[model samples]
Target: MQAVFATTQISERAAAFLPVERTDGFEERRYLDQRQSEYLRMLAELDELLLRNAVQWYQQQGRNADQWLSAVAAARQESRVQSGQGSATRRKSSDVFSRARKLMGERGFPEDQYPPKLVGFTPQQFGLERVARKGLERLKWELERYEPFALSVYSGATREFRTVNAPVRLPVDPLSPGEVEETCILTGGDPFAAGERVRPGVLSAVAGGAVVQLPETVSGRRLALARWIAGADNPLTARSIVNRVWGWHFGRSIAANPNNFGSTGGRPLHPELLDWLAAEFVDSGWSVKSLHRLIMSSRAYRRSSRPADAADVARLDPELRCLSCFPARRLTAEELRDAMLSVSGELNLQVGGIPNRPELHAEVALQPRQVMGSFAAAWVPNPLPAQRHRRSLYALRLRGLPDPGLEVFNLPTPDFSCERRDSSTVTPQVFVQFNSQNSWSRSLAMASRVLRETATEDGAIQQCFRLAFGRSASATELRQCLQHWRDLEAVQREAVFRTPVPPPEVVRDAVEENTGERFQFTEKLYGMDHFVPDLRAEDCDARTRALADVCLVLLNSNEFIYVH
Candidate 1:
């Protein structure tokens, strides 16, 4: 845990970006600070690539959980001691500094005027930091007992550390509600009483036909409650999951309101089928994959979305309750984002990894927001294309903030469990889908991919249709698209575009939470010196960009976004 967010491991490629020494004094410290900035900028990349799989890898190597934390710490120490690199550099620098001092003394220079950096630089001691949770809440009361105590952090400007040599204390039982209410609360040596605390206890809830009480275990109450929920006697759990699965496969749920199965919820169209699936779910040990396979293999699921007689089917089922054919529904927010990435050949298939901060709208990415009393830190995306292209399943979800691209498509609020999301067609959805940077960039990538794999411009256009819509274009459609591409190329011929676009390093200003004074901090953009970017407008010629424009049109079409 100590090294989980450690900012000391500099990328190997970063060394090339390190500045060359001019004829100047006090340069060593500046070099050190630059290194500090590099690590900070590489935060997203390192977090995803390293430290993430340490515990899992250790377990796979047959090590215990207790040893993994130690392994992480040892790894950091080993990195610092590579061939005694840190110590060897210090020794070499000292030799150079002494020779300079002697030569200067021979020239009748004052020792007081000697450069401070000539003595050799001392790197800051990156001590153990207690990175608190969002609310600074301890995960468990017992965790405090085993948690590492914080070591001092060196403040470079002031050269002070009040936190150094701090006292440590283990967990103590919190006062009872009655005791807190009866006793006077004191703050800053004065009385500061609070309202009466609500007494804590579990309330009985109605589970189906029975009134169930929460388990009263000394510990593992969560485990006990989970077991009771999935127990043989409880049918609600299986029924609820089965209903949700059916809703995903079809456009609507077996019970229309998947969130609530009570009297207030909508009535089920096929109660017998729902019951059978629920029974199968519990019998198969609650396996979701098994449920998906069973549902997909059915004739109803395999039915064509286009019916032979649509009017007759609509007359028979006005609300689509009969499931006459497969329901043609727009993709969910996640699916829409993933599909675009997949079609562009940019989707990273590596599963179960770090949450990614995807490229967002410029206005949203640069928008200022407060955290507690100070402004929040800027959100930095991972530098590498592979890292940036992770699926939206692993996208970071901030409670109050959201990705604007995903939001226009009806992404649910992160704080709530939304069983249903309305896919309303708003004006912003049209703009984001067609004109947004995300869409344009993806289309550019798709065009580049097709251009590389196919020979002729015709083949590239055909390939775009296949990749985006899963089929070849018809004769008339092909002819129209060909004309469209040529016209676009004519316009693009005169257009000038920038190339080798470098990612930015942000310098953010914020008011200090404690001091209420504004200050600025540099946020390094990792891999800026050696970043390999995706294909852009300037990377391709007029002809290629025109094909890219056609690819963009295909991506914006309904056929690409709907599961018809």
Candidate 2:
């Protein structure tokens, strides 16, 4: 998982495990979490083993659970001494030690449970020991080496926090990981055991500053937020979302990167028009359909993809900065698969429902995938046409099991939201398009479709062009295809083809992890035993075969793939 904080405040759930203070460095000096540290502590003493670097790697530099906890102790001790309570300092430390020890005790782990690599020392004692063993120069050098990672984690924490708190200010220990000592102090049943708890009001204060005001009522709140977001006064929300919709539909946004609108991002070619649309969206009460209508209705949208002036296109608008002509775009990963099925007269346009499992690679189908605490079952594609050919968006089984074919075309991973998809052409994409079973099947299906649409071979040829290219074949194109078909007639006569009826398998199954045993079961594949139209090689004649080749070229052409 690539960890990124869109802004700073980490989620409360994350904050619970890694408190805010641990992330924000302390004003005072602090130590490390040695017991969990890979270098110094004995793993046996810990109740649960954490990959030493896992949490540490996530944490901002100069901070750790141990350091934050130590600071909390120091602060508490200072408070105690200030109040003429010097006698309780050691007692407080001992109390913390006891709690730590008790938690370990409850686990009932043997003394040498883990690596049993070394004896133990608390984080502070270990740090001082390190100072002696490695000298100050070595310590400084090591810190420098790990500084970037620490800073990145810290920045990430801050970014996470900012998402919720929005410009929140919590005092930080630049050198410590985020930790909520107050949350931990409750372990003793003393609400104020950690001296003082962070005020809940801190969050409200931060949120109040950044969030736009909304109505108090539920529906009113949503409406008000919508108004604010779509309002002319707001520059980001409407522009961002609309740009995303356009990019999704057309393959590219007016602005190169849809989500990013910062100065660093590519400038919009039609800034005035974009602003006009944004204002119109607000005026229309943020209706998505309205924006779609505006864009799709424009002459700009319908222009031919071919650029008339290639030299001027390269020179005057080298980057295609000006909308000189519509650029043809390939169908998106989802659209490509869906469109192919549709063109083959085999589409099943069902709407939303539970996701179906489209077929996956045999290797990937059997590969083990992990969920929260256990492994998930291998993927099985939808057995029925209706489920399988549902709109690409409704296609099921999207738990990081991206179709390899789709991924080759830049399908986004579902684990996180993708604001915009990248469309870079690469060699692997060509390989997938040319060689994959899916491609071959789709190709043959085109041939069968052409033959079915027209009775005579010549008529079938014309139908193929009309269906595939959205226009009748030109005289020259038809002539060339006729010649190609004569050659292919002999090739098909010698070639053997089969439409494999895949064996049914238990699509969903259960497995016992503890015992390493597998239990299999099946679920209905939806509309089983129904008449299905598959790509059949036997269905096509010589002329239909020629048209299929022409259709294949059209589908593969750059003109059909890109959108202006």
Candidate 3:
């Protein structure tokens, strides 16, 4: 790729004379061959290559390849325009005129003499009609087979390569004026409608009481808007950012509503503190880490949750406005689930790629989900435990169906930005924490880890405490856990062990929108087919079951859920 770019340049004289001359100028002919070889070598290194453009390039290198390549390029440009890549105003007629002029120029005809109808001219003039048609046919066949290929390009001085799997082809016709107007009507507004045409300009209300001029192009307008927001003279951006960060750490912003700073929002509790933090955040070059360090290292930040004189402080400042103590907060849904997996030694720490399919409740996974004219495939957990046990942050989030456990814990609907999560106590959260298969599985896993790592009951209890609360259990708590375990073990000593039942096949039913007919389809249970089931009461002995029971209780306790 680098070699291709380095060897190409455009000829100014050709650009002046030809309507559509080759933009890429090859300075070194030998370099073009070398780079092509290098590109092929790179493609060979990949597991598979899908060469879309490369096939055309290969055919072009034979007879009058330059003209063939130009036709191919024009086709690709037309395809891009059809796919909505080209700007609205220029995409309609200008691209057609440009291509026609280029074709006429290549044929040694005067640009002015080229008829507008020739914009839809076939590639036969360039002796590429047969090859282009053949290549496109092959592309379609290969795409159906999921075959992949690499695309290659070369012009005056530059060369480029790309890997694509789908078919590519030329546009049939340039968009007519009526078609362009129709598109504008659908997406923006009718250009002919009264008071409907949009003109680019900054809002007078927001532009410091004056209308600010802006360029017409999308990129130019975006750049101007970005500058206005991030400009040093603008006082709101830095302050808003600091407030949001502060809210995340403290569970409440200095200005109570982090999303709204207008007249309707709550007044800042500590206006001076807010301003100072904002100023410091700006001074530190908008470094998030620097701001975090400054805030967290403060003496006020380190204050204990239980102040030295709680009663006195409460009476003097009921709101705790003096920063007397740190606020206690419940862990967010993601944090709670991730923490459980971490403690159970089952967490897959692999980072960043596509969203992972974590195990969801059977009911939710098998539920029928509607899509265009059909029921979508049932939710499938990743086949391997490593993939399925990834952090909750990596879990696939669906708008219609969220993971039930996370939802129970108040994971917000993702349709809007969530400034803060609601932490209201609810019964569903209790059911999910104690009875759900996800919770029981993690508890059993934690139990196995404790027994494997410890020798005695006391040691196992201590290990459980350390994993759950980051501290050893107190004497009273240890004694209570020991007694509970002993009692449970005695009760389960004579219990029979049974293998767990596999999930039932999911049957989804949907009505056809056009035919008014109902149909049912069985969704594949991909995850369960390969799942290595976790240890259950049936799999473990009486003693282990008792320990798992104890672990389950600890997991559901306040100590595991709250952060002070």
Candidate 4:
């Protein structure tokens, strides 16, 4: 019979109690703290009693309860006598297991099946361990009548206010384990309680332009905010979205500033047109496609940038505020990059996938970038040409590590919302277009594409113009380009061009944290070993190289970069 019941349940539970295979270091107090000592003590008594009267206890079923109680009383008295205490007390948890060993020998069970000897396990820890195990049923029953656990209230923050007269502030105890709730003060620096709660209401310039009180619910804050944002009374959302789409096509938004609409922001240039668009936008069930269709089909939108008496119109309307003609503006950084790739016949139109790693300037890609003390891995362009030439929208943008080609062209950082891009022609833009490897590579590919599509040199020159400027070359322009190509071909046949030399790994110097000394480390450039580089000057014949030179000139031309 076991201590808790007239079965082997106590022995079985105790056998599975210790987390370890054996209580080897219990004598050194190592595992004794971790084991459930009370479980062991209970098993000790069960084993001792079973060895002496297993047959007698089962045969006398009527007297089993009385006999078990008597045995418990006897064990307690023996524990008290052994401890030299004046009153009866629970037996030492560690010694109880020792007492079980003597009895197990008489039971004829193998030594391996004996209870774990928790030598240094204290009775106090056993009390906690017991409450955590099966004996927890008893504690839970008592707790159900009252309360067991409750969340703690109150928190503290450092008195960092600089208005204090004293030179040094008093040292305050820091927050301990799991106590990190911070209370923001409303009227005073009270840390014990939370701030004064504000009435849940929405502030907006719609529906009489005042704060509207929200209906209260069990959980109302987020739900109230959602309703207010989507409410029919709020037309700000409709106007703002319409202005952004309008700005994307027109280069300048109706409101001038898409992000700001307050008194500080410029008033809409064409208020009536903006209002009509907004009204139609809301009426069409907020469909973006409907707005695009309406705007693109307008006569004003279809107007040519070069209207009749262009010089007279330029003098009459210097700002082009009359909206008599379409505006001619440079393509955006993204649009420019995509246009070049499209011209080269390498644009990949695949949508929605992993962020692409387009080829960057060598200085930027091979440099060691530090991230929280360790060096970041080398930047590797995608191995496949299709993946490498994905649309600029899918390219990965790292903060403070701008891709030189796009950055030079005034591509805004993704760190914050850019209501409008600032387009300025800088010296770097010229270098990126004329001197950068990416530009040269695109030109070479474009040349290859033109030659592959056209039958003769004259036809290839015409194809280049169509792809680059979206128009056929004039007769005079075609003749000049053909002469330039012929002359370059003669020079290129004598010119020496070398193949690209991509390094397998780049070695960089880094500072060692422990020694405070610089050391060199190697970073493997992923996919560089198997990189499929774009067409280069050395990849084709002298005629193709000369045509690539012509393509480079076209790519750098203002006509190719600007959209009319």
Candidate 5:
């Protein structure tokens, strides 16, 4: 029976012993004998050198714990002294140590259980030693009890403060007649009555005669207003968005006036399509890209600009509102300039940084305007051509001085949102495209590109057509272009060779607003000092010059300016 028990002794039952549970005398004696025998066997199996090394390691751990505790205590004392809280801080520190020691003693780790070498250690170190000796259960219990207070103390110690100037508050008294006039001038508002003051509320007409309550605070009122405008129940927001996008693609919205959608505005020609699109836009979680894809991929959008049947042009779509075909529209000013630069290989497509300064006409660039007391600095293009050739989207937008080329092409003033661009066929546009120095330079560059990419005159003409319009020229167009190129070459051969004159020095004249006295200042042309001028007629051969004239004609063609 003893042999049978010995085999089963070290099995699962041996791992389930409870030290506090009392056992029968015979069982208890057997357990003690078994444990002693097992320990002896384990010691015999272990290497003597390994056993000695383990003992040395445990001794070194105790020494390390002692040193770490000593360092922590010294650091605490030094912090207290440096912070100028001498004796009071010392007394509080002592109280902390005393409380910690008492807590350790109560938690089954009495002072006598600790090593003799750790007797003089700080309470912080003593607590750590107790946790290490008693294991994770005791450490967890200690942390749960004290961690909140420790966190609060740490937060209080690291709190920061800064000095800030107080804001000036306006008086709450009613405005005087003079003050009301001044307020109207400053805010661009109608003159209020003697006791009138602005307050937050919905318009009475929109509120439907119901009592509407609003928050007293300004920010709360703004948030409430924003919620009202962006709420899911608002159909106008979604409908207006769809109409604007439609207008952008077709040059006219389903509703004629994109900004005005009320009873006063022109009624939508296709009300069902507009309502369905708005509903779908809202149902798709207000996704703009999904809405765009839905509209752009439709059959109506893909239809050819030309009518399928000439008879249907008058009967089926008299007003061109039946979606019979796509509408051909002139490119906007920004699009026109960007396209020209792109075809000439002068476009810089780098995205998103500070706005660039494209080379403006010298007259506009050097014009002086009164600012404060003195005249403002001259407008200079960015030094590098890469910057000067950036897309029109990156061009610096000045409200006072718009780009001359863009202005001539009917670019709206920047004072308000342009719901739709006007595409008027003006004579100035022709001059800007054909006569401007910038246009001449771009033409030269385009001609150079054609020469570099093509082997023969016929190939160059075809290449020019492909670059300008997205397709090759027809047989008649090809023949006419070659003839024009030959004629220009003969004319350029006999042209007088004159030295290219530089732009004249600019003298800025501004009248002082305060004194009404005129002042003249020489505007510095810093960008011109390192300017890399584009290819010109003088720099190229007669053939190249003639090719530029052909390119200039292509650039000014109706096909290049309009998008079908």
Candidate 6:
């Protein structure tokens, strides 16, 4: 079978564009004694050729004769060091010193004695860089031509050379929008047809083989690829994605680097099990749901997130080589917000549709956004409950606009398909939770729900624990929470209960354009005239107030925010 190479492999040739300085500053005796000396000789010759070319360029431009003589002296000294076979300190300052003296001794008076210099003699600036660039251009041309010929035969004949006919492919520079558009249009290739050959397979003349061009897009490509990759026949892709999923769940993939599966990537700890799961996932109709079920069903996933085995602490298992215990992980950006809304009885579970705008913070919502040429209209949430309440996944994702809260929680940008989400803890997350008005509103709604369900202060506290931790609170926790509720109740009696405020009826603003002009328009809210959820704190008695306290705590705890 003929071997194929990735684009990266071909691109690796560009590394040669960087010139290798032949001045190793060592005597040639070291390399000469060893069979490896021939390599060094060739390298020195290449470097000498580079320097000679530079000198010739300068001489061509009518430079002083001293410049050419100086270059020749320098070359002689370089040759001496490269060829001499003596101790570094003892041997020859003579050959180098003689050259230096000769360079210094030269004093010229006649214009005719001047050495030729390249048209512009600016003091050795950009000379080396220019040479390197020229060398690269020559190399590129040589490689293009060499592909057709330059073959040596075992029958002892001179290498044959043939003219090159390879197509010249210009790279797209991102700085030019026109170039980018052109590339996109050219690469897009017959999008009108469902099954059209977009790119032709490349056939190598020498190799007598071809590289196939696969379809770039397909209706069920992801599903089909998933099936093939996860199947027992394919070991690479299953291990790759599984490790990725593991990384998302535990903040560390079993293979360390999830995407890389070559010899360089860390070997799997439970290789057999990984293969088993990969095969199982494929056998189970490539069902994503089934895969999740198997993973979550494992004893590894269910073990207490807390460290229970103290003596086993010595066996830290730094690499987490075994299925010891469940790893605690921070909730994903979507999960964090979704779980909060779910707990607070405010999550909208409506499925797919054209993305509806959700309520954004006033500071963010009112901010000006730039579209193609002019400022785009400000974001306005759907006024109706069913519309605004849809899942975050299904929300109309703006490429230019990201929810500030979600951003703080490490939500991935929508520009590219994200393989996994990053969970990073930072101070911004703290401010997002405490300072954002959205969090406050959510807390209040949760508080009210708890107060309505559990009348007494103690009962409200227990309910808070139940809602947040999914279990009843201990006696001590209940006592502490009861005290907190009693204090809150006194405060609530003096201060009236608040109702959920209605969304804005209309937002009027001048839209700014990229050209710096503004246009005025009033964006109407569809259902703003309807009754809004009332935040009527006064309507509820002390009992309902207590449940609100429970709800508030439940919404605030780490238990509510993390997934183990």
- lDDT tens string, model 4, 176-220? 222322224445655455575444455445546666665433234
TM values, all candidates: 0.63, 0.55, 0.65, 0.65, 0.62, 0.55
Rank list by lDDT: 4, 3, 5, 1, 6, 2
What is the C-alpha lDDT profile of model 2 across 1-564, one tens digit per residue? 001111123221112222322221211111212111322222222312222332343253433455334433554455446446422111112222333333334557443322222124334333333322222222232223222222222222222232321123333543234432222224376745553322211122323366554332212333454455455666677777776766666666767776566577878767787777777887888899988888888776776667777887778766544656665566678878787777777676654334555666666665655543333334545545555666677665456577888888988888877766667799998877766666656666777777766787677678766766677777887887777777777776676656655443334344443334444433222222242444555565544544555567666766455544
Worst 10 residues of 4 by lDDT: 1-10
For model 1 the TM-score comes to 0.63
lDDT of each: 0.61, 0.52, 0.63, 0.65, 0.63, 0.53
Per-residue lDDT of model 1, residues 1-564, tens digit only: 111112111111111212442222122233333433343333323233334443445455564545334434554454446525643112111122234334445657555433332122111110001111111121122122222333222101112234422132211222211121222223454546443422212222435546554433223344446667678767677888889989888878898999998569998889899989998887888899999999999988988888889898889876667778888889988899899899889999876534666776656765666543233434545556777788888787776569888888898987888888787989998898898878888988888889889998678778988999889999888999999999999999999986535446666555444334555555444434444566678878888888889988998888988888
Collision count for each candidate, in order? 0, 48, 20, 0, 0, 27
Candidate with top lDDT is 4
Question: Which portions of model 1 show Cα errors greater than 4 Å?
Answer: 1-215, 499-532
Q: What is the C-alpha RMSD of each candidate to the true structure, in Å?
A: 16.9, 18.8, 16.1, 21.5, 28.3, 25.1
Greater TM-score among 1 and 5 belongs to 1
Candidate 5 lDDT at 303 equals 88
Model 5, position 67, has a per-residue lDDT of: 33
At residue 29, candidate 6 shows an lDDT of: 25
- Residue 462, model 5: lDDT of 92
